[model samples]
Target: MPTVHLLDYVAGNIRSLVNAINQVGYDVEWVKTPEDVKNAGKLILPGVGHFGHCLSQLDKGGFLEPIRQHIEAGKPFMGICVGLQALFQGSEEDNNVPGLGVIPMRIQKFNDTSKSVPHIGWNSAINTGSDDTKNESFYGLRPTSKYYYVHSYAAPYNPGVLESDGWSVATATYGEEEFIGAISRGNIFGAQFHPEKSGVAGLRAIHAFLNGDQFQSLSQDLVTGKENGLTRRVIACLDVRTNDSGDLVVTKGDQYDVREKSGADAGGSVRNLGKPVDMAKKYYEQGADEVTFLNITSFRNCPIADTPMLEILRRTSETVFVPLTIGGGIKDTVDTDGTRVPALDVATMYFKSGADKVSVGSDSVFAAEDYYRAGEKLSGQTAIETISKAYGKQAVVVSVDPKRVYVDKPEDTPHHTIKTQFPNSNGQSFCWYQCTVKGGRETRDIDVRQLVQAVEAMGAGEILLNCIDKDGSNAGFDLELIRDVKASIKIPVIASSGAGVPAHFAEVFNKTTTDAALGAGMFHRGEYTVSQVKDHLQTEGFLVRQFET
Candidate 1:
């Protein structure tokens, strides 16, 4: 097998990149020091998180010059995500920090006025200079393919600006902003989106770059459309726990209950759906935009490094290219060996194990309550703060589990309440979403609005908003809750729970401003595949990412 040099810089989930490379028949060689770059024939820099941190780290580690020398020596080099951003001179994200100055361009944050700031999800990377007659896709890129992108800053696309400088560019539009998604020049390649997580389409790009095949012509049938915008993301969630037999299994809960409702073994055995790793791959193949495994079963008595969930993440990422989020047990805890582990360390374990993002559930509620108790002051020591600081905030996701608390009007109990469309048994016309913890086993004093706001201030990148009233109900998403939550936070909100059918997904997308929608039972029970929901969304005049062949 051929070998390509990869830089182990910063903290992120780079396992999938390695997996992608291996799948494409290339083995990865670590480019550890400045001296290592001179011997490399093909080098790839994979990065995530902040631009300043990426460039500053490389410079601090004495790698900046060697990388420059590698490119000047005309060796093949590729940059991904922040690795790509580091080629520019500087960015609006950090004016004090200087990039490699390779491109003489600046990256700017996307406008949040019309859409989400991070510009998360699948978007097209169309090569503007493609041959229309031959249907050439620059470096395995296609008009129809949508690559996974999650970033706040990007290089704004200006027609012929980089081309005049002998650089080829592919652009994707987010709202009204057109930005560079991928760019290439002699001996150099950069992708703002994550190719490793883009499924088969991304694997082809990696193969092309490694094989030095830039201008791969495509069949006209592959060019399905010129739609070049961020599409809606449909995520598949697996609630995983141990059954009565002590075997790890994927399980679903009804309003947070995971026991059998009826039978001789009623309420005796935990519901077993399937295996975590196998189910994850199945969803990926079914066109699920992302797969999440919430490790609901406790492993506190076991060592963090030896947890079974880590192994699950490791195995699942090898085959599932899309983003994988791990929730539950993300708080600080004492290991079985009497070693105290911080939440950041727990998150690092998961990230290194191949989780793209770490979702905080119960801990977030406690943190938010503490925040309000301290008069909205930051402690800078909480799980969210520490983790977000180490890895970019984009890597930290707050999983909110809230139950609807009914009231007659907005003034009831001094909580932020909305006029409810569905009245309670007592004829209450208003409701405030009260946050819950321990898988909705306990209710907190804080409201959902307060919890999300506090976490966002604490530097959480996204929210996994789950409604206790909706989970496993197969009724539909709590639209009123989703809308209120979306209205409160600037970061992305994933509407989870209560998705029964494909039409339910469409209803959430149409009725609410949620950035993404998640399905668990529907996908788990073979009731609906992710492709069906995406197809429904597409038919309803919405853009969605189709599974690449």
Candidate 2:
């Protein structure tokens, strides 16, 4: 019941801050003047747009002195995005303009060519100082829970700061420069990324901040116990595809042809298959939390079984401990007697083959009644229970790929028809896209919100939501889509598609209620390693899983 004051300057992402604060059960009061900061339980200063203009606005509103006073008084204060940069003495974005100088550092532009400007995508972080106890404050961050970042300049960690990344700073990079993503000074915490825009992980950070001592205890418990609030994972997916040899692959740019008998084959012989096991191994190593492997392909032909791929996966499972959720090309299985094959029996095969979770996609959407009939024939709950008994409930994950459809439109207008001339524009009249399955080959008339409710009702433990429009773009997560789905469902939501950098992960966690983030391209290409990503999240004060020292 704390009244949180969100400092409202002309240059802040007000909406994002408000939504993030509200998500964690805190009441927010938007304040533009200095007097509004008085006696507040907590304070959030969010900055966006131009740096000079933001400082001028804060000065005009007489907030600079009050904010400084609040921090000096040991009040819990969080600076977001530019707000973090503003704490430094100054930034290269506007060198002539001075910052608040709360922290002894200067913001500078990243000149690295390996990274892009505006530091738009998801990136990771690393800790530099020798103090593991201080560094472990950010330990609960899973590799997939990345924060969002959008900036041109950042404050590089100096002697006063404890850590920095290698490529960027403290194992985190923005624009390929080692920049400070987060700076903590006692009760004052600042993040270069928007925690409000980040999904559940961001919210958890906020919740931890609000809870104060309770969160500290939880952190201590996590490091000591190593397992609390650890529950069964449910994940959703998007943009799944196969390599030329019909092996699972996730990439951003070109399509590479798979050659038979190539060294890429796991069999090490003349086998016509790619190595999905190699891909899965990378995911497990990265701390997937869980994965929903959607086979993004035109399912006109019967799904081919990659026996060699499965064998590799089986062999890989002997080493990997994470759960694998497999979806795509599953319809109905029949025996010689014409009796339906049980879901449990089929799931058992996947389990025996090293898959901990079996996700039904096109089969669940296109043949709903038949799918349910099959489920009933196989005893739906019985199947789930059997799998739960066998591998534990945490291993059972159901993936629902639902798209948004406008509900306020006229009945006569075609659902897919574009009334406006520009088909790709983000217009107010065009409210949503209908959920499609069968590799986007079939469209479902149901609204995405409704579909989420339905999926949750179907006893699914999780939902992996993906935006077809945003898939494989390497831009950023579709935050609006994620926000909507997260608001509608109680089940955990794994935001997929459009994860280009570690900062994007931070944004996803800050912006929505998404429990996890799933990406294929950034990891596969060696742009970021799992530890690098996790370290970045930790520096930003996110709760992530950490290796016990």
Candidate 3:
């Protein structure tokens, strides 16, 4: 467990900083004074207020000297917002105030008015380095990822550092001048934008820094073993099913139980033969770093793991080598006249069948008793954990489908009793949705938040949050669900269900602290390729997965 030191200064958003770092699997300690930096494994300086005020606080707190010492010692350090600009010689926002001077540059105001100040919204970075060459910092990075830029001044481009775009300024005003939006000097990295707030790209960049050599080398050499320049990831999903002819087709399910419950038709269901592969290819072309194929019908139909379907995927993967995860019919135990087989064998089969990861849904939830029994029987935490330890957490995914159910209230009236639908502030007068299993057929009063925490405790590395309300609706993600789940859990969350467009991906990343986003309908219908989505996200300043071809 590596430790990350977050500088607590006047300009920093302490909560956002802590949330971002924790999302990437690291422990964070608040460093409000110079002494806090002395024994830090890695140091993060995040600022939100005025640059001059931030500098003054840093000096008063005596952090400037220790920070310099840490940087000179080749320790991994990062500067965000004003914290980033403060690392340069000085900023125009406050005249005569000196910066860390680690990079030979000064920040200046953008005198243009065509574009608004603070340069809000999303922007792309054009890699100034050779397109054919990539460094560890840029690994798994798409051409562009959405970065939230909020600044009036920018750092001028210098050849001594690698720039993401040709606009010399890290960020610039509409038509006036270019300024540094971000900067990197060996082990020291600075960003004009708040990566924590920047969404998935920001998270990916942070993760990369934590996992890359720069952070590793610094952490190793400095006894903290942390480096800079890591970013977060945004993912897209495509759900594949079989048509009458046994050819792979794409369709969306309705509310996760339309077929099982009220006999409602599967919303967005369509015959999309050979479309999933095409959409996946397009996502790769568009710069999607990774894509997932959720065989939505595998478990329902009890069909033998689709070998031909996987073969098509294997062939498609050759052209676009992004990480692929497949899920649906993974059984850990089979009862045939009291005979049982280990689920690890099924997982191994998936790995050999060309999946980078395997997801367990109904099997895990419906068989909780079995898993609990197995854990006791096998002397482990749970059956899932036992299998995960064998295959590695990265290779195991837990799919959680939760629905919102209103808590009974005396004032609440049935929808059929109302003449005109008047919406309440609480939205339908409902309380909270609990965790649902067995394809949304069984609603457990168990608290979803508690369940999320429990799963993490059970050794789940990641959670695929699929909203039963939004499933196959093409209505967009349930922001409330994503936001609540994100706030409550520290593990990376993959937001699934109700993704209608590429912008939806941007919105999810921008609005919540979710790590990766998953979609199926949009990709299945050829609505947007993963590469196209990545390109859009990259233009928005998101760091995405890059494809060589």
What is residue 104's positional error in candidate 1, in angstroms? 1.3
2 or 3, which is superior by lDDT?
3
Report lDDT per candidate: 0.91, 0.55, 0.61
- Residue clash pairs of candidate 1: none
The true-structure Cα RMSD of candidate 2 reads 19.6
Candidate 3's C-alpha runs over 4 A off are 1-232, 257-270, 273-278, 299-313, 333-339, 367-383, 408-430
Ranking according to TM-score, highest score first: 1, 3, 2
Better candidate number, 1 or 2, judged by lDDT = 1
Please identify model 1 stretches exceeding 4 Å from their true place. 131-134
Q: Write the per-residue lDDT of candidate 2 for residues 1-549, one digit (tens) a residue.
A: 567888766522244455556666788887756787876668888776567777877887788888889888889887877787788788777778788887656777666343323343334333333132643444223223455454556776564334332111223553234666555545767777655534455566677666552212223333332221222122222234555555545433211112233356543322222245665555555655444454545232432243333454465454444445665544455544456765556565565565545565554444343334455343344443344444433344555555544434546434332233223444534455466775555677655665555544454455566666666567887787777776665555677777777778778877775667777566666677655666777676566653222
Worst 10 residues of 2 by lDDT: 227-236
Predicted candidate 3 versus true structure: per-residue lDDT over 1-549, tens digit per residue: 577888876522244456567777888887866888988868888775466777877888899999999989988888887778877788887876788876556777654333323343334433333233332224222334445554556775555354432212233223434445555556776777666644466676677666653321111222221212223355667667776566676555567532222335233234453566776667656655456777766633333343455665555544444456677666655543344546666666555554655677766664454433455233343545655565445456678878765534524522111211323456655445467766677876454665665555555556789998788788888887877777776556788899888788888888886767877667666677666767777688865544433
- Candidate 1 has a TM-score of 0.98
Q: State which candidate has the highest lDDT.
A: 1
RMSD of each: 1.1, 19.6, 15.7
Clashes of 1: 0
